[model samples]
Target: MSGSPALFDAHLHLRDARILPFHARYVKDALDVGVTACIDCATRPEEWAMEVSSSLAATTAYGLHPWYASVSVPNWLERLECVLASDPNAPVGEIGLDGIRRVHDGGTAQRAVLFAQLDLAARLGRPVILHGARVWPLLLRLLEPWADRICAWQLHGINFSHELLALPFFKRANAWFSVGGGLLKPAARLLPELLPHLPLNRLLVETDSPDRFPIGGDPLVLGQHQLLYNQPGNLRCILRAAATLRALPVDELAEQTAQNARDFLAAR
Candidate 1:
């Protein structure tokens, strides 16, 4: 690993309350292993505030995740806009629709919030980090109108499908695909098989730390619940697994994905 390229976690939540108390250790461990950069995403307004106050060294992204969509305060949109406006380089997201969570109005609220943020990103010419679970088609349909307007889209934790590649969003040069520890699961046969088919320049990697802990991940202890939290250091394990699936040397893949991450983040 002496000559390995520094890794980039394209999407994660270092500002997450669950792991914030020990973020310094998590960041240090990640940096020691060559994860030189990370895009720390805030799922809601409070987390955004935490990002502003925290000392974590990361490129910050702000948005309301679907799970928190219905619970957002009245002035959340205005606050979100202010955060993005404060930093032009920052991306807008970790935002999208999730059908799995039972929201009051059957996802109507999620769509409304998602559109507002998407429109804001387009207006400000910022890239977006999107999350769509059990609502991929609806997300795609929602994105079509703004596909050309937004600078870039990081489809975080994507589940690959050949049909998805044919969509206008995927056809655009601005689209990026980020994969995480979920790809290491035995049941994720499709992702491994289709991994090579994804455009290399648009592919990125992440840990989604404090969640999505890899199959053989290096665990960070969570004392109260006795839970295993995923840390950024596990990116090395993910990179190695991805390299094997793609039949490329780990270093080669690391550099490629790192460059891809830089391009995605720097877009616009």
Candidate 2:
């Protein structure tokens, strides 16, 4: 990997308990394979500190995921603010509406949490890492007001239609889209169509480690067996998939997306 361009895993969750024990292994593999950076996204309050601390070679983001919206913990917002304030440059994110899963109060609580984080991100002039599954339309609508205020934003693992690009907020400068390993699957829905429509400069790649594992391979096994665990090193596979879609050399795509990540993170 000496001559290969270093890669970036635009989104992942290093603080996940299942992955924690293997954290050092993941980092070693990522670095060994030329993965230079990543964004470790925290989904809740308890994981925030560890998320930041564990990202020794990557950027860190802390946010209240929509699934945890109904949590009745005291001073969560205040604590979140304290963490964001601790590192003004770190992103605010992994926050957005999720319509697919059942949550308390039919997503009302989720909306409240999402909106509050959006407001906070806007107020702090921080870039955001957003997650939208079955709620892209609502997410776009909710982000309308901060279209101008927010410094930058990345929609992680977005598999939406071309219509998303037409949204006012998406049209704004500094909007980004991260392509994950999911696109590598033969049955990928909107990615094949969506990738061709997106500007390469605004595109990024991520493994969403320990989550959206690519189709048809055991990431944890290389021999005859299979182990279905995603890791930061898997970013190489995603970069290859994206390179095929963009019709560029893998090294070229890696360089472009690396620069894109730098620019996106600098938005804060």
Candidate 3:
């Protein structure tokens, strides 16, 4: 990793309960491989507190993910606002619409929670890390109104759509697209096509670790369960794949995307 450019994992979940016990090893492994920083996207209130209190050397994002929408505490919104208010640099997310899963009200609860979080992001002028699965059109429609108010946002683990890049958010340069292990899948077709179209300055890379384990990815061994989990150290592999897909030098793409992550986190 000596000659490799330092990498930033724009999205991950270091505070996740399953990974929390092995966080130290996870961070060390990533650092040893040149992944110096990351954005910890906490999907629930407890994870948010953990991220804020931990010494992970990464930017922290606080939000309520769609999966936990119905189960979230009544004061979750207030708690989220307090966390964001406490750290101005912190973004609001790992939040958005998920069409595939069945939640409390057949998606109605998910929409309501998403709208609240979006409104909060808009009011605070915070950047957001978004997740939309099988519902890009609906997510885009819901996001359109708040696009002008929120300073910046990233679509994490996004699937490709021709209309995606054409949105006002992209045109205004307020949006970013993050890709991860999904790129390593031999069956992945849309992302490869989406890569060339993404602006270098607006592109980002992430692991979304503990999930979406890249095909052929180097797995982090979890001793207790003997489970293979993705870790930030694997960022280098994702970067290499992205560079090849975009026809850019690995170092060049690495440097640019690292800077992109910085700019996005620092965006007002």
Candidate 4:
């Protein structure tokens, strides 16, 4: 965290040529720019190994995400167990409930799958990076018992305003919010209000990459609404934006967030 320091994108998705060509270039760009690390999220058993294989220097999480909500519980669990048995080092995560998205999942199914992953992680004594949307309340309810079991919990791609971050559970729990390109929106300045609501020690930055960007680099300021893309390289801009919002030096902002990521990883 001294000198130029390093940027660790807590969450990202980069598909290889065998899987998809678009993300290969994106991954190269991130590595070329010296991103410290990115956690490649696996959304299904078929894609779990790809997530682990895609990590050139970053890490990976094995489990089915919200999109596979309709995917039967036993099917995904078998795949998760296979990945775990093969790679005991791989963590189980990027799994949770989502009410905001149009995933073909039932509320009960989402809860069931998420709980199963948590149980698996607990047995393995590994950590997790959660993805909870409108179902935050439900997520907390299920995760309460295992609060100390997870290594980390990340709320991905959120545009949360200042007032919505007032949950007391977050203060007592072990989790962090991974803010993505949502901060690039025109009303981004409202982010300052969000900083005060959390434990302050538990905050992280991410691009969520390809999906968050979709288009290409457009800039977080004037072009926030230009439909620009998101990437690991853009995380620096996110750091800068956060620094400005908090009225702190850029280096300090980067250092603090880096520590937060470390703490999240180590706490598990």
Candidate 5:
């Protein structure tokens, strides 16, 4: 193994069947590029089994994503607890409220599920992975009661304003912000601006691969002509963009974020 700290992907959905065929390739690419750790977060029931079975060489978190807050069956919470209990290292997450995607009473269901997971995380003293889309204000408010209870939190694919970073929860709850390929876009407002403000120790990075496929983001697809998905290897682009915004050397940022990710998992 290399002496330098390994690169870390703070969040992604590697267990998704869409990327199953590329598993070996993804692992090789991640290793070749020095990315040694990742948190593969599962959103709902379908991914739970895959998330458990996959030998992806990464930590995993299972939770009901906000999009499925209303749809996920009542038994999910019990199942999630069972999974988390099975792996001492598994954390609770990818759980939070969404404002943009409208479902029947989505906001209400979102809050209910979020609080349940938060309660579970607190009881278990496990770290949490949170997702917020346009619902920052409410999410922050909801987090207040559980802030002291959470062991640690990673705001995945975070794109919030700098002003929001000043909130006491960031400090009190021990939060880390994850930046992904979204930062590569020139039009992205929050990430580029927030990069400089992130405490080096609290800064984390991810590809959110197979999702946020930005311009020039990676994978040397040989036969296929069309762009279909993303790989964890594309994290190079995200790290480069973040390094540029933070005015830090690539290696330095990589090491810092890797250490941060380890600490995040260790917090559990």
Candidate 6:
């Protein structure tokens, strides 16, 4: 694909591409949003085959996520290694710790599994599309050794606090922030501070289609009440909000971010 400044969604989940209508609608929503490429992140190990087989994008990140943590996760790690070794093109990701929710198995095993993928990515030389919840510290700690090895690392779905960005761990890492409908949350007003520091190339846009939604409560909005029913197409609102915060024209930022994503995948 030629490098066009069209919008690019760096993250998304396509569910199961084998399902016909799901794939059709997912692709339609992405196109409607001008998304040039969407990274479908898979958490379940058994879902990797579906993810790989289903992804229409030339580039994608494949790995087990903490959400599917179990005693068998380690074995899936081996399976992931096999896929990566054979293809060696897919970025290693959708892998990280989520300590905030129902992680009944605890993080010790999760960390071990996460680090193993990190090590594999480093040795093989590829970028990583990450998932970090309250586990930012541990995420950074696990990533420390592999920082230089990363082509580009993205923190999916957050406008992180300065403290996390200020830490020494991120000093060597190239950080990309993904903002979507979730930004509509009152807490997401933080974008004004977050967008300025991140440059165009480092900036990435994503719909996380049929999956991404703002952290805001579903209340009837004032001007556009239709938005109360959030959908993937609403990513346009996210780009508009982000552009306003950065003080740049929406079209310009959209093009730049799209290019940024294409360049990111190229690096791999």
RMSD of each: 2.1, 2.2, 1.9, 4.7, 2.2, 4.8
lDDT of 1 by residue, 226-268 (tens): 3588988899898888989888999898899989988988889
Scored by lDDT, model 3 comes in at 0.85
lDDT of 2 by residue, 157-194 (tens): 88888877888886664788899987888888788889
Name the top lDDT candidate. Answer: 3
Q: Candidate 1 — which residues are off by over 4 angstroms?
A: 51-57, 222-226
lDDT of 5 by residue, 1-268 (tens): 3765577888988776777676766677677777777899888878876733433468888888998887848689899998888888888878998877877764787888899899999999999999987777668866887877998998888887888877767667888888888787868887788788888899899988778777778753535654457777787778888888888888889888988898988885
For model 6, the superposed segments whose C-alpha errors exceed 4 Å read 1-5, 16-21, 51-58, 71-74, 215-232
lDDT of model 3 at position 72: 44
Candidate 3 clashing pairs? none
Which residue runs does candidate 2 get wrong by more than 4 Å? 51-56, 221-227
lDDT of all the models against the reference? 0.83, 0.83, 0.85, 0.66, 0.81, 0.66
Ten-residue region with minimum lDDT total, candidate 4: 214-223
TM-score of each: 0.93, 0.93, 0.93, 0.80, 0.92, 0.82
Candidate 1 or 4, higher lDDT? 1
**Model 3 residue 240 CA deviation in Å:** 1.0
Comparing candidate 2 with candidate 3, which one achieves the higher lDDT?
A: 3
> lDDT by residue for model 6 over 117-234, one digit each (tens)?
7787777777788888666666777677777777678777665555566766678876667766656666655555676776667777666655545554232223443333333445
Q: Total clashing residue pairs per candidate?
A: 0, 0, 0, 4, 0, 3
lDDT of 2 at 31: 82
